[model samples]
Target: MKITRILNKIDRRFHPSHIYALQPDHDLLRENRTYREAKDIVLLSYPRSGNTWLRRLLANSILEAQQYPSSIQSDIPFETVVPSIYTQSIKPPCLHRYDEVCHRIVKSHEHRDARKHKTVYLFRNPVDTLVSWHHFVSNSPSLLQQFPWVVDLSIDEFCLNAVDGWAKHIQQTRHYKDILLVEYEHLFQYPHQMLANILDFCRIPRSNIDLDQIIDNQSIRKLKSVTHSQELRKGGVGHGEVELRPSTVTELRQYQQMLNVAWKPQVERSLMTAM
Candidate 1:
């Protein structure tokens, strides 16, 4: 028993994936305790659910044209404007000094809580999200180590699992009265309109915000061109039919039914307002 326990500890130390699964909440609390007081805007989503793209959009919208590049390389320093709580190595400035800034956006993928901070939850089709996530995790060595299950599952299995996962994510955050829910498909379909909505949700005046320029610069083509990884591949909706097998498609359809039932009212309301 002692030997087994010691081996498990050693395994977790060497394998980050095991550690993450075992102590996700503890890790999140430890890493994000500082930001509890000062988070101004919470950008919440499941992993691979358009968080990075939205961050780019928000950062570019806020930054001056010259300061924000047209084509962003993988290493662009936009974290100060829209930092991710999950990715930050040091203490987040937003936690200490959000009042000093005009807009502080913090990204997260945790389950929703009762925090009163303004939140924007991004929702993508689970089929597309899972497909993207699978490719993303499979391609990145670090991600593979952290999420070894991605390598073991077929695409259909992943989508079936992701359906349940995303449904839970939606159920958790859907009821937040102050939250603004944004659909990933709409962001692509109507970039100007969605950006305008997001800017409004963040309480930024659209007067000086050039929606045209931000949309053009942050378009999927431009983003994919600069991002040299599978993470940004084919950033459009309905690609799941192409990438996922027929069995996966059938399974995803059933999952989509559950998602629509849970999210239809909120999503419809958002779309109506956007229209």
Candidate 2:
């Protein structure tokens, strides 16, 4: 067991692709300015809002269609298909390749910027998102150390903080003309249709692509089984109903009111019933 743990640590430390695991407060905007400027497509979301899942789906679809090497499969060093500027290490070979790729698909969790990239904004219910994020950080020692508040606060307190951040993120980017809004619930419920919609929005041809294959490949179970990382936790929807405290539900409702989110009524109703 000790040897196995040691090997796991070594693999995580040296893995080429693990470099894309994002650190808190990463200065991706400043470091990746040139790549961002040239990128034609972006997948934007708040942390824990299904960004990785969507990235994997898009990567598998596009790479397979292009007949790229199988070595760069969904969760491997597959950032090239859709480079996540925020998470990818800004070093030599990756940096050089990022600059060279045209119409690149970049992932970001930062506030919306003035770049003209066609954007897909993935959002989830703040309640579930926070719950997932709380568990995610709690499981990741590195992430918990980076954001110590995750350890300092109860899940309720964390959700309260998360709601405010989620509101601000939504307010910042929801108005963009070129942005496509894809809700996590919708994606969970209708994977194929949602994938098709995303492809259509991105102007990618869906006729030749097998949506079912992409959906199967990116299913939550498949991702969790394949990845050794704890990031992919229980992938079902609406866990907040059972998991979140009533106080957190109230806090989220108030935030929705303050932000004047369009889905406020629906979310509030859900929260009330959940509580």
Candidate 3:
């Protein structure tokens, strides 16, 4: 099987794809994009949140203006996708403080690091995030270890973590400006506008990018058919009870009871949301 991994902008010698940092620390040099020079527009999100499709659209839009520069884009994904082939890909190795401009397009599930870089944050209702996460990463030996709760988590327990938000504030925070908080629901409904916003964030020229072409683009289909297939579903509002066993449902509720009441509605809504 062919594993998909693409190296983004990074100084290969100093910042290998093996290491990762919350924010890049590009150093200075004559031939590289220093931290000051790294004009990055990153896509931030948790797993299965649809950034893959977003990134592709951005790539197509940018490539179109460039006019088939030399075979479109060679294959994207910087750290996250590249490391995924190993089965437990989490973060990439860190690079030196300079050469940050090596890859302009990047995708990561790691909580956002670079506090100042422009970012597009995508969030799914915690319920779906958790359910899909469990299904997608259930087989990942890494997730099993990182999230000990997952090993023996009852369905309810699973829901709690999903909604509790990731360690770095999936629920709320005020870290940086230029962030576009995109709920998963809007992405499917307004695919074009969503794409436009992303390009806008990246400061990418939008002249040649066709939003419709991207939605129907082969890469979108390719990703769904490949490793990312689990995400094909867009999600509804509620009713997981329909598919889960009574025993499992009971177990899930046990954990759900642990969350703050404020987040309950959101979590409950996503459980049944098929996306």
**Winning candidate number (TM-score):** 1
RMSD of 1: 6.9
Better of 1 and 2 by lDDT: 1
**lDDT comparison, 2 vs 3, better candidate:** 2
Compute the lDDT of residue 210 as modeled in candidate 3: 63
Clashes of 2: 0
lDDT of 3 by residue, 122-236 (tens): 7654455556656665665544554444566555445444443332345442456566666655666666766666566556676655657655662443545544445544344
Q: Name the best candidate (by lDDT).
A: 1
Question: How do the residues 1-275 of candidate 2 rate in per-residue lDDT, one tens digit apiece?
Answer: 01112122222222111323445535653577554554467788777787787877787666555544332244346565666766574343563233232346777765443346688888887777878877876787776554554566677765655565577677776457786777787778877777777776776665557778777767888777778664566667887757877866766656645654575454344334323
Compute each candidate's TM-score over C-alphas: 0.79, 0.74, 0.58
Q: Please list the residue runs of candidate 3 whose C-alpha ends up more than 4 Å from where it truly belongs after superposition.
A: 1-38, 69-103, 145-149, 218-223, 226-275
Q: Give the TM-score of candidate 2.
A: 0.74
The CA lDDT of each predicted structure is: 0.67, 0.63, 0.47
Q: Model 1, range 1-275, lDDT digits (tens) per residue?
A: 01112122222232222333344455654566455544467888877888788888877766632243433442345565677665553255433233332556777676432257788899888788888877765677765666565666777665665566566777778558688889898888987888788888887665556778777877788877676755567788898788778867777667667778777787778877777
Candidate 1 segments exceeding 4 Å error: 1-29, 65-76, 89-101, 112-114, 146-149
TM-score of candidate 1 versus the correct structure, residues matched by position = 0.79
**Steric clashes per prediction:** 0, 0, 28
Candidate 3, residue 46: how far the Cα is off, in Å: 2.1
